[model samples]
Target: MSALRFAEDWNEADLSAVHAVLVRSYWCEGIPRETLARAMRGSLNFLLHDAESGELAAYARVVSDRATFAYLCDVFVIESRRGEGLGRRLMERVVAHPDLQGLRRFSLVTRDAHGLYAKFGFTPLAAPDRGMEIVRPGLYLQSTSERAGT
Candidate 1:
C-alpha cells in the first residue's frame, strides 16, 4: 500500500470517492451528495486518500466552531483496505490537525469500533451526564420516510 495523503479540505470532485468508501464501510449510512458537498466546503472536514491511486480510502468530518467543542462525525474506512492501519493514520491527522489542537473536547459515537478509537485517547464518555448519540431519530425517520415514498 502507498503512504496515505491527508487532505484538510475537499473539492467538489472528491465527494464521490469519499462517498464511495462511506457507503461501503461498516458504518454504512446514507448521506445526500449535496449535503456532503456543502460540508466539504467548510474547513473542518478531513479526508484521507490513497496516495498511489489518488482515491479516497477513509473520511471523517469535525463539526466545530474551531474552538471549545468538536464532534467527529461519519468516520469510515473501506472494507477491502482494512487491517492496513489506514484508519489509525486517518484519525491521527484529524486529531492532530493544527486547527484542532486545543479544543475543550472532541467526541464521537461508535457502535463496535471502540478498540480502534480507544488507541487514540478516545474513551467512552462514562459519566452519567456524558454520553453520545449513536443515531439521530429525526434524521433516520426522515430518510426512512423518503425511501418508503420512493
Candidate 2:
C-alpha cells in the first residue's frame, strides 16, 4: 500500500472525481454536476490522494459557519480502496481540521456508517428526542423525474 497524502486544495479534476464517485452513492445519485460543484465551493473540503497513482482515494467535507455548527457530508472512499483504514484516516483528519475545531456541534447523516463515525466519538444523539428533521426522501430523484416529466 502506498502512503496516502491528504490535501485541502482541489481542482476541476478533483471535482470530476468526486462527482464520479458521488453519482454512485445512495444519497447523491442523480445530483447534478453543477450542484456538486456549488456545494464543494461552499464547504471545507478534505481529499485523500493515492501517492502512487495520483488518484482521489477518498474525500469528506464540512459545511459550517465556522463558529457554532458543522455538518459533515459527502464522505466516501472509492470502492476499489475500501477496507484499508482510509475511511478512518479521512474522519480523523476531518474532525481535527483547524477550522472545524472548537465548534459547538458537529453532525452527520449516515445510513450504515455508525461504527466508523463512532470511532471518532460520534454517537447516536444523546437526546434523540431533541433531534428533528424534515426529510425529503429521494430529493434528487424527484428533481430528475420532474425535469423529465416522467
Candidate 3:
C-alpha cells in the first residue's frame, strides 16, 4: 500500500467521495449532496488519500467555534481501507489539530466505534442526561419525497 497523505485541502471530487461514504453511513444516511456541500463549506475538513492512486480513503470534519467547542462528524474510512490503522491515524490528526486544542468540550455521537474513539481519549459523556437533541431521522429522504410529491 502507498503511504497515506493527510491534509485539509479538498476539491469537488474529494467531496463527492466523502459524500458517497456519508450517504451509506447510518450517521448521515440520505444526507443531500447540497446540504453536505454547505456543511463542508462551514467546517474544518480533513481528508486522507491513497497517495499513489489519489483516491480519497478517509475523511472527517469538525464544526467548531475554534475557542470553546467542536463537534466531530462524518468520520469514515472506506470499506476496503479498514483494518489498516487509518481510522486511528485520522483521529490522531483530528484531536491534535492546533485550532481544536484546549476546547471546553469536543463531542461526537457514534452508534458504534466506541473502541476507536476511546483510544483517542473520547469517553462516554459524563453527563449524558444533560445533553439533549432534536433528531429527525430520514429527514433528507422525507424532504426528497416531498419535493417529488410522492
Index of the highest-TM-score prediction = 3
Cα lDDT, all candidates: 0.75, 0.90, 0.90
TM per prediction: 0.79, 0.91, 0.94
Error of 3 at 145 (Å): 7.5
Off by over 4 Å in 1: 23-28, 130-135, 138-150
**What TM-score does candidate 2 get on C-alpha atoms?**
0.91
Q: Candidate 2: misplaced stretches above 4 Å? A: 143-150
Comparing 1 and 3 on lDDT, the stronger one: 3
The C-alpha stretches of model 3 lying farther than 4 A from their native spots are 144-150
Q: Write the per-residue lDDT of candidate 1 for residues 13-83, one digit (tens) a residue.
A: 67887766555444545656765677667637777788888888787888888878888877877767888
Which residue pairs in candidate 3 collide? Answer: none
> How well does candidate 2 match the true structure, expressed as C-alpha RMSD?
2.2
